[model samples]
Target: MKAIVCHELNGPAALRLEDIPEPSPAAGQVRLRVRACGVNFADSLITRGQYQVQPEPPFSPGFEVAGDVLELGEGVTEFAVGDRVIALTLHGGYAEQAVVNVNRCVAIPPAMPYQHGAAFPVVFGTSHIALWHRARLQAGETLVVHGASGGVGLTAVAIGKQLGATVIATASSPEKLDIARQHGADHLINTSHDDIRLRIKELTEERGADVIYDPVGGELFNASLRAIAFEGRILVIGFAGGTVPQIPANHLLVKNVDVIGLNWPAYAERHPTVMTESFRILLDWYLAGAIQPYVSEIYPLEEAVDALHQVVSRKSTGKVVITVGD
Candidate 1:
């Protein structure tokens, strides 16, 4: 079997393709013949040993994958060989085969392509849990999404619209803002050229947004609080903007706003039922053509470094993926 190995904490640039022995399924796990692997920003962080959840060195750096089941371990009776499925793994998704726990794999919709299936689990699941479960975003509410062109941001946009919210999307560039608009954003704000708080205020007629979905922290979070409406909720998705923002109690008291922390990985562990339900909703949405993930680019396994570069450099528009095979 061939795999991309990060033998040292050098970085994504130092990742190399090497021939390695295949791994078999362990107890309560399933072995999959990987067809596609999703390249997330966390993959870059994991390779460089910067992410909070760092595995020991000499590891493969991928999380979500779509493939065919080759074998199932003991006590696994829900699936069988050759079943097309998507697996969410802690690591080792960059290989030709990956072993994931039976509880972590889900059957992919027959109509969904491998590229999109590979990219779906993490970002879409995170967005759904944040907006629906944590934030309790209601229909007809005014919703603001920061970094709206990225994978997680766009997923929020799609889900917000589907739930009947009036979605306002913000991006660093006009092109990215346009991408958000195409994904059902009711209004677009280019934070690079326009002041986000001011633009959002004007767009909402000075009432402010009912909910703010932010993956980009730092100064933007402060501004999001200022632009929040009375009794608004702010969903802290991630700190993709390099700095984690601090929320002052005074600001929260002024508008009665709630700043909710959304950690999907932790939530998935505590509430496995919700994770399954979220995947089911996403699969139904994909089948109905109501929500589709935007796969910006796909690279071969050998070009995994380039794929990571696209994300780390912020040059990629949507989810970037690595195709293990065709």
Candidate 2:
């Protein structure tokens, strides 16, 4: 097998594509002949040893993948060998084969392409759980999404609309804003040239947004504090903006807003049934054409580092993936 091996926490630049022995599944796990892998911002963080669960060294750093089942370990009976599936792995998705727990693997539709299947799980799951379970976003309410052109952010915009919220998307450029609109953003605010607070206030008729889905925190979170409606909920998805925002407790009290910190990995463990339900709903939506997974670019397995660069540099909208085989 071939993998992008990281022996040190020196970031994506230090990642190297090297030939390595294939891994077999342990108990309750399945080995996948990986066809495509989703590249995430967390991959970059893991390379720098800044993410939550750091593996010791000389490991690949990919989370979501789509592949064919090669073998199933003990107690794994839900899927047969050669099942085309999407899975969420803790790591090791950057290789030609990855081992994931049986619970994390979901069968993909025969019609869905491997690239789209690879891109689906993490980003869509994050948004679905954040909006529905954590924030309890209501229909006919106003929803604001920051960094709306990025991976999970774009999913947030689309899911918000599907859930009957009036979606307001904010991005740094007109091109990005256009992409947001195409994904169902009812209103667009250019963060670079336009004022987010003022535009959101104007668009919402001064009521402010009912739910703010934010993956890029920092200054955008500060703006959300000011722009949120009374009793609004701000779901902190990530700190992709580079600076982590320190939430002011007083601000939450003033408007009775809830600043909810959403970490899906923990949620998935605590409520495995709910996570499975969420995936079921999302997969149905995908099959029904109610949601679309966007892949901005796809690189071969060896260029996995470049895919990570595209995510970290904010050059790619939606998802960037790595194709593991010919």
Candidate 3:
């Protein structure tokens, strides 16, 4: 099997394509003939040993994959061979074959393409759980999504609108803002030049946003703190901006603001029921055509490094997928 292997804790540039031995399924796991893999910003972080669950050196960085099941591990009866599924591998997805725990795998909808299946899990799941389960976003509330054009941010915009909240999207450029608008954002903020705090104040008649979904931390998170409603809930998705902002407890006390940190993958280990229910609802919405992944680019497995670079550099919109087998 061909795989992109990282021998040391460098960045994406250090990842190299090489022929590696095929992986086999263990008990409670299944071997997949990987068709496609989702390239996430976390893929870049894991390469540099910055992710939450860092595998040792000489590991692949892909987290989510979609493919056909070649064999089911012992004690796995939920799925049979040849079932099409999308799985959260945590790592080892940047290869022609991968072994993933059956618990982390969800059967892909029949109508969904391999690429869509690969792109769906991480971003959509993160945003859905963050807004619906964690934040408890309500209809008629004002929701703001920072980095609204990126992978997870785009999903937050769609989910916020689907939940009936008026969405205000913030991105670094007009082009990115336009993409967010097409995905159902009610208002747009060009963070490259606009005053985010003042804009939210103006847009909401000074009431501020009811929920702020921030995947880009740094200064944008600081702005969200000031622009939030009195009882607003802020969901901290990630620090894609490279700097994790320090939260001042005074701000939380004054406004009754709730800063919630979401580790989406934790659900798989600690709260499996929540993950299962979330996936059921998400798959239902997908079949109803209510939400769809916006895959901006697809790269061959040989160019997986370039794919990771595209996401790490924040140059691509929506999801970037790496197709494995033809």
Candidate 4:
């Protein structure tokens, strides 16, 4: 099997494409002939040893994958060989083959392509669980999505619209804002020029946004603290903007605000039911054509480092996928 292996904890530039031994599935796990892998900003973090769960050196950095079940491990009865499926692995997705726990695997909808299946889980799952389950976003509320043109951000915009909220999208450029608009954002805020806090207030008629979905956590998060409506919930998705904001308890006290931090992957381990239910709803929406992944770029497995760099540099919109085989 060919895999992109990271021999050091430096960055994506240090990754090497090499031939690796094929892995077999353990009990309760299934071996997959990986067709595609999703490239995430976290993939870059894991390479730098900055992610929450860091495997040792000499490992792969991919997290989600879609492929065929080549062999099923002992005790796995829900899936069979040749079944099309998507699996969430901690690592090793940037390879021709990956072994995944059956519990983390889901059947890919017949209509969904392998690239979409690979791209679906992380971004869509994160936004759906964050807005629907965690924030309890209401239908008539005003929702604001920061970094709205990026992977998870775009999904947040789409999901917010599907949930009936008026979504205000913020991005660094007009082109990015345009992409967000096409994805269903009701209002656009160009972070390059507009004042986010003022814009939200203006868009909401001084009431401020009822829910703020924040993925870029530096200055934008500070703006969210000011723009959120009273009793509003702010979902902290990530710090993609390169700076982690320090929250002031005074702001929360004054506005009765709730700053909720969401680690979407935690649901897979601590609350499997939540993840399963979220995926079920997302896949249903996909099959119904209500929501679809906007895969911006697809790179071959040999250029896995370049794929990771595209995401790490924040140069690509929506999802970037790495194809393992034809």
Candidate 5:
């Protein structure tokens, strides 16, 4: 089997394609003949040994994939061989085969393509769970999303609208803002030049956002602190902007702002029922055309380095995937 191996921690350039032994499933797990894999910002960090969960050197870096079950492990009765599925592989998904726990896998909607199923689990799971469960976003409230054209950001925009909030999307460029608008964002903020605080103030008639969805941190996170409404909830998803802000507690106190952080992957094991139900809702939304995935680029498995580079360079929007096998 072919896999992208990282033997040293040197960022995306360290990823290399090589022939590796195929893995077998353990108890409660299943082996997948990987068809497509989603490349995330964490892939860049993982290859460089900067992510929170660091596997030993000479490992593959990937999280989510769409594939067919090649074999079921002992005691795995819910799935069978040849079942098409989307799975959450904590790592080793950028390859021809990967072994994932049965609980981490979800049956893809019949109408969804392999590429989308690969992209679905991470981004959709993050935003849907954050907005619906964590933040408790309500209808008619103003919802603001940062990095609103990128993978998780775009999903947040779409889900905010679906949950009945007036969505304000902030992106670095007009083209990105346009893409966010197409995904149901009611207002667009070009943060490349516009003042994020000023724009939110203008859009919300000076009250500020009711629920702030922030995946890009650093200065943007700081701006969100100023732009959030009184008693508003701000969902901190990630620090994609290269810097993690040291928030001032006094500001949060003054506005009665609630800062909530959601690490979606943790729920897979800690609360598997909630994770499964979240995917079920997303699948139902996909089947009804209520939500759509935007896959901007699909690279072959061997080009995993280039795929991660595209995400690190901020050159692609929505999700970028790596095609593995048929």
Candidate 6:
């Protein structure tokens, strides 16, 4: 199997492609002939040794994949060989074949393509957990999503609208804002050209947004607090803006707002049943054509470095994937 191996602590450009031995499933894992691998911002961080869960040097850097099961590990009865599946592997998905825990794998919808299934788990899971569970977003309420053109951002926008919220999407460019509009965002705000706080307030008649889905923390996170409504819930999804913002307690206290932190991986580990149920709902929406996992570009497995670089550059309108095999 050929995999993208990171032997040193460098960025995506330092990732190397080389032939590696295929992995076999353990007692609770299954081996997959990887069809596509999803590249994420975490993949870029892991390659640069900046992510929280850093595997040692000389490890593959992919978090999610979709493929056909090659062989089932012992004690695995829910899946079988040749079944198309998507799994949330911690790493080692940017290759021809990989091993993943059975619990982390879910049967992809029959109508979904391999590329979408590969891209679904992380972003969709995050959006579902953040909006439905953490924030408890309500129907007819106004929701604002920052970085609304990125993978998880777009998912949040779509899910917000699906759940009956008047979705307001924010991006830095008009093109990116257009992407969010096409994905069901009821309103769009280009942060570069307009004042997010002013626009959000203007759109909602100064009541502010009922829920703010902020994955790109930093200055933007701080400003979002100003646009939050009374009793508003701000879901903190990530720190993609290169800086993590510090929360001032006074702001929350004055507005009677809540800042909810959404740690998707930790939540999945701590609440297995909830994770499974969340994915099931996402799959249900996907099968009904209620949601679509957008893949802006697909690169071959050997081009994993370029794929990660694209994601790191923050230029992708949707998810970027690696085509591992047929």
TM-score of each: 0.97, 0.99, 0.99, 0.99, 0.98, 0.98
- lDDT string for model 3 (32-94, tens) is 999999999999899999899999998988999999999989999989999999999979999
Candidate with better TM-score, 1 vs 5: 5
Better of 4 and 5 by TM-score: 4
Q: Which whole-number lDDT from 0 to 100 does residue 141 have in model 5?
A: 97
Estimate candidate 2's alpha-carbon lDDT, on a 0 to 1 scale. 0.93
What is the Å distance of residue 177 in model 1 from its true position?
1.2
lDDT of 4: 0.95
Q: lDDT per residue, candidate 5, 196-294, as tens digits?
A: 999999999999999999988999999999999999999999988889889899999999999999989999878988888888899899999999889
Residues 130-196 of candidate 2: C-alpha lDDT, one tens digit per residue? 9989999889999999999999999999999999999999999999999999999999999998888
Backbone clashes under 3 angstroms, per model: 0, 0, 0, 0, 0, 0
Instruction: Enumerate residue pairs that collide in model 2.
Output: none
lDDT of 6 by residue, 1-326 (tens): 78888888887777888998889888989999999999899998888888777898899989999999999999999998999999888889888899999988899878898999998999999999899988988999999999999989999999998899999999999999999999999998988879888999999999999999998999889889999999999998888888999999999999999999987887557898888889989999988889989999999987788888788788887899999766
Off by over 4 Å in 5: none
| Candidate 1 runs further than 4 Å off | none
lDDT of 1: 0.90
Model 6 ranges off by over 4 Å: none
- The residue ranges of model 2 lying beyond 4 angstroms of the native Cα positions read none
The C-alpha local distance difference test score for the whole of candidate 5 amounts to 0.92
User: lDDT of all the models against the reference?
Assistant: 0.90, 0.93, 0.95, 0.95, 0.92, 0.90
Q: After superposition, how far is residue 315 of candidate 5 from its true place, in Å?
A: 0.9
